[model samples]
Target: MRRLRNDLPYTFRPARPKDWFRPPALWLNRHWLLERKYRVTAIEEQGFERVRELDATGDSMLLAPNHADHADPHLMMEIGRRYELPFHFMAAREVFEVSKRASWALQSMGVFSVDRDGPDVSAIKMALSILAAGKPLVLYPEGEIYHHHERLDPLHEGVASIGMKACGRVSEGRQVWLVPVGMRFLHDPSVEATFRDRLTRLEDRIGWTPKPKMDLDERILRLGQGVLGLKESEFQVNVAAGGIQDRLESLCGQLLEMVEARMGSDGAAGTAPERVRAMRYRIRRRLLDVDHPPGEDERTLLLDDLDRVFAALQAHSYIGDYLLAEPTLDRRAETIMKLEEDLLGFPLYPSARTARILAGEPISISEMLQRGELPRKGGASALTSLLEERLSRLIEVPAGAACSTELVSRQSGETG
Candidate 1:
């Protein structure tokens, strides 16, 4: 997981796509950066024709992909290049603040910044405009890159809301489509050795002797428990005794409640991410107010609250049963990688991998609304559930079976 930073004020950055720069930028990303930096050796795409057919009709499209890795945007850009389509991307504001050159490059490639902590009306309007203009807009429903490739985080409802609202804004004959894209990464078998080495390094850092004789899965679970215990102690909460999943939930709740108590605000009832966003928004509103800036002591306290909010969200990202359910090699490696990133403060360099890009059949927003299939009262939530179900099935496509060009209905499990 990328570290969260709260030093910068929230600002909206709109997309300024330069057609001249996108092709070469995409070329460099595909030819060099993805292969060399992200270790992606191959990319296999399925259901791209769905996007092409939608584009042919001049219909507006919103590409909703699971964001399991940081390389997802570049991967999507490569896909757009292949289909001869240009895309507009909605990204977190912190990314644009990384550097001026990065912000410039991202904007040139049609990426815009969004503040996840607050009501970012500007970002929503930008998305509506992009879709209204009959262009492909890419939004990650799973807002954060949690690095859990096999499982998707709870999706934000904003994507569904944007798609539904865009439908009403498009021209008469132009429909709006929500395309659920599933992205999965397969690590090369050679990376198993690297994970073993990483495990040893992590043990050393934690002041424990390397458990070479222990089962790999057991070692990872033990490390995770220890880390969880340390966090509990740090927060002055009694170490909960139970299964990892239960303990994780308990700790996350305690942390969020702690922040809420400090802020004297009842947090919004939802997932941990939602509660964190609420707390952060309240805290930052005071922190960022220039006219009535927080006093030095108040500022210090608010910053601490922000840190705890980040920690709670991070803990929530690690679903304990992920590895136990499947125990695939990829899951084990991802677990180790996440540990190294959290404990060691930097992610391990991933080994060579192949990315499977699966685009599901498009969900026509206008058609659903027109047919009264989607009720306006809770349409966003309903549409979100549908998209989530489709994306979950798409990501579950077996490695050997995902490369086929045939359109496989996620519902029927049949091939044409």
Candidate 2:
């Protein structure tokens, strides 16, 4: 739920990947930063034997993990430290813009910047080189952190494309493997009180009297609706008449359509995130064109369009019945964390948590191509689906008791 500013021009930041720096940096992060700041007290890694096995065979590896939290990259560093592997990461360019020191530290840690709003050729080339050199590369196919630990957003096919293309570059007799790494965070049960306090604060911020007597699920839903309504008003959107999910989808769609219209482009056909990316790419290309810079008024409009693009993405993240379907403590906490970020402009670290890092079976790109499973026409999509399915299985939630129908109905009442 990080709010990225799109007004800045992108400069591709390649990976320096200092072998000497990574070990100590990771140790410091694991011992200090993660435990003290991120509240990730423990990290348990599973199935990394597969990673070790692949490393043993001199095979190239592309580790695709489901991105659920901002703490994921640090957790990956912990894994690399535990297994003694050099891991290269493809991170968003916005992260590098935080500060010069942070950017330098990230690059030294083997992290490169990628402009998610556009095609970053530098990042693709770096990834290709990492894989071709028989090294392990980590890329999150989910791309953005939605803070939904139990479920995954759609997997971007670009990861599969990079893996397949890297396969073509590898020396004969060697293979490139795609490993789906699942990350799940388990918060301490005592943190429920902290979550409740967060909900109360959100209610107070929205000018509503705290509802201590209300069930936790209902309070969360009401808070979400309140936040959504505020966003709709801010964007001058009509409060769509429907349940939370429906209203969210409607608002997101309208926002994207607005951006597309302003950019003088036809609507892009894809997920909300995809369309937003396409529009942002077009707008940024124009904005960054120094030789033919946009006029002051036009620049103002373009910046406004960028704001709408981000708003659309934020709305899209909340467009689901994540809590209503099964209100696990993790789900409830994640929902509130997202709300905190959106409302207060920053999220508070709730409590100490354990991150379970499970590496699922690796899918061999070479074997799939040889087996004709990856046809030329839709090979990327096919591979993406397979990767998505694997990651989903690794983090699959057990069927459990859900909220009663009456409660769900009450929670879904019209928010407009």
Candidate 3:
């Protein structure tokens, strides 16, 4: 067993393969694990043969999939089996800590641990080695699962950076390609009944009574108002009189400004998402900076500041009930799921839903480099846009479908 050293980041270690690789076990487990747990009815694959064709050419490929649900990685596992391709996935370190058995199984399935809160060279080196060996690497650029289906969040540059950097080290004629994979989990129709029941239970649990005549949107608005009122009281900010969206925006702005002031930042420009992201980056850097560790009081203060910032960020996602605007079956189900998750602090994984995995035409790193499309400045942003565009095109939503307008958190945003 590999051990984390004192010199390394907490839980950091070189990626290690398990004692065995059991393809049949993994394939069987995928069928039972995802279906039984998440109730995924069927996984429809589009253009999967193209990926097989690319693999046949012996060129390295990277799988960059948008993460909207926790079941995404499991879906990818099943896809790997169907395509007859084994790929390595970079999972957050917390997953491995769930249990020794889970860690072993994950490692055997070509999963490596990533410390996303800070830079970890060990994980990057492992990724490069996987690409150099002509193996496919599955890296979700979104970093975290957003649970907001139909909406594509902003992409992180890490996926492009790792793939491009590895491609640069390839021998003369070989090429590396980044495949944009989009996974869309359609909501189960029965979610409406379940949603009403769950929301009723939540209201009861909180000892809050709703009007008998309230509609779905009205109830959502009421819940939002109650939650926002509590937060405003906690923060000692005066309740601003406005529409739900306006009030939410104002309150969140105030909360964030509090953190920024404490951190010595003005945040004069940029959208709320951008400001929250910068604050998080600064907080994480300070918290994880090994060169100069904070003293006891300083550490306590920093932790408290981070807690407040995260709370404010969480509040930002619930603004305006983006799911209620369209009121389509899909939107209703998504909104219901989001509300349940917000109340329950986890995913519901609604039942009998079809998941579509569409692989877009692979983006060629060599071709992009040759065309001078990549720049030292903003290269990752350009690449992120290209991948997001490709994946977004693959997702088909109804003409009037709309989702929450919450700004995608930079640290946790997922591409389409």
Candidate 4:
């Protein structure tokens, strides 16, 4: 250990439920925690006021927020700064480790790692400890930001998993809460001309094309600073208790049952890939729950991943980003080799567990692709010819529509 320099302290601090939403330390937060170059309205007075209510409750909390723009975390930090405690954010490892200032900002903001591609064991352990120690954590259940839409990426069970694990592990399952926070921003001038005016100009400067995520953040932060006009010292906070996860689960279960009850004879044309979707959804949800105000860099890694996924799906192409390789080991072959070690021919994928038992073996990407997960959205039947025409579709199509296009295409030969 080259002695932890002017960097952030590694020693874990004792945390309290309320402490989760405040700025971490004076040094890191003072001028720029959520400071902005532009002035906007609705920062502290409008948007974050709801979160203030959620934080005062005395329990180990899991703050789940809908992801809209990158400003989601930034806005959260603004509230935290006002209250004066930092969240232990679970962020991409590479993004955090890239530079000293970024690392310090993250560490001071209580940052940690959750590698999206690899095992997030360390991050998971870190999160459980924070809750066990009695602190609240923040996570984006959606896992990635998107165009603000009405539908949520069906609440991933991974969030439930973390809650389950933390509940048991934290003080033997005593005080645990999952706090849901929603932000409704009005960039439209009529709703809040004060916020809207600044928002438009900032959006122009940043050139978000449709919308820039950073500008959204700057708008909220500016509203927090300029519109609210805190005396550079005065700050306010509010907190409220939400029902336990069990209570929420019961309610959600009831709702789901009602939905299923009404779903009669909407005959299934195809089975939803429930198993695969559940797994992906869970991993993403878990990553979101365990991390806190992910700094800009970490946010980019995840956003980039989402972009790659969407691009691959839209283009009818296999997804692989040579540029964004995340495995610690340098070579791609090494990453594959590690996975091979675990499955011994089972195509374990991104894991090398149980290597000693099987000895040596070859990795299998085909097996993973066959299972409909390896290449991600590329595996969809409409996206992949093998899964579409050759497998299930042939059985369902009308007989006349099933013939090859070229076989009966001699229009001139049968000019009836």
lDDT, candidates in the order shown: 0.85, 0.83, 0.70, 0.37
Which digits, one per residue and each the tens of the lDDT, describe model 4 over residues 334-390? 222222222132211221111000001111223344465434433323222222122
What TM-score quantifies how close candidate 1 is to the native fold? 0.94
lDDT of 1 by residue, 66-129 (tens): 9987678888987887788898999999889889899999988889999998899999999999
Question: What's the lDDT for candidate 2?
Answer: 0.83
Arrange candidates by TM-score, highest first: which order? 1, 2, 3, 4
Off by over 4 Å in 4: 1-40, 44-58, 149-151, 188-310, 313-416
TM-score for each prediction? 0.94, 0.92, 0.83, 0.40
Say which candidate scores most in TM-score. 1
Write out the backbone clash pairs for model 2: none
RMSD of each: 4.8, 8.4, 7.8, 27.3
- Between candidates 3 and 4, name the one with more favorable TM-score: 3
Which candidate number maximizes lDDT? 1
> In model 2, which regions exceed 4 Å deviation?
265-268, 397-416
Please, what are the lDDT tens digits per residue for candidate 3 over residues 149-185? 6667667778988878887777778788999987777
* Model 2 C-alpha lDDT per residue in residues 56-123, reported as the tens digit of each score: 79899999999988789988887786677788999999889989999999999989999988878888
lDDT of 2 at 122: 86
Which TM-score value belongs to model 3? 0.83
Candidate 1 segments whose C-alpha is farther than 4 A from its true place: 265-268, 404-416
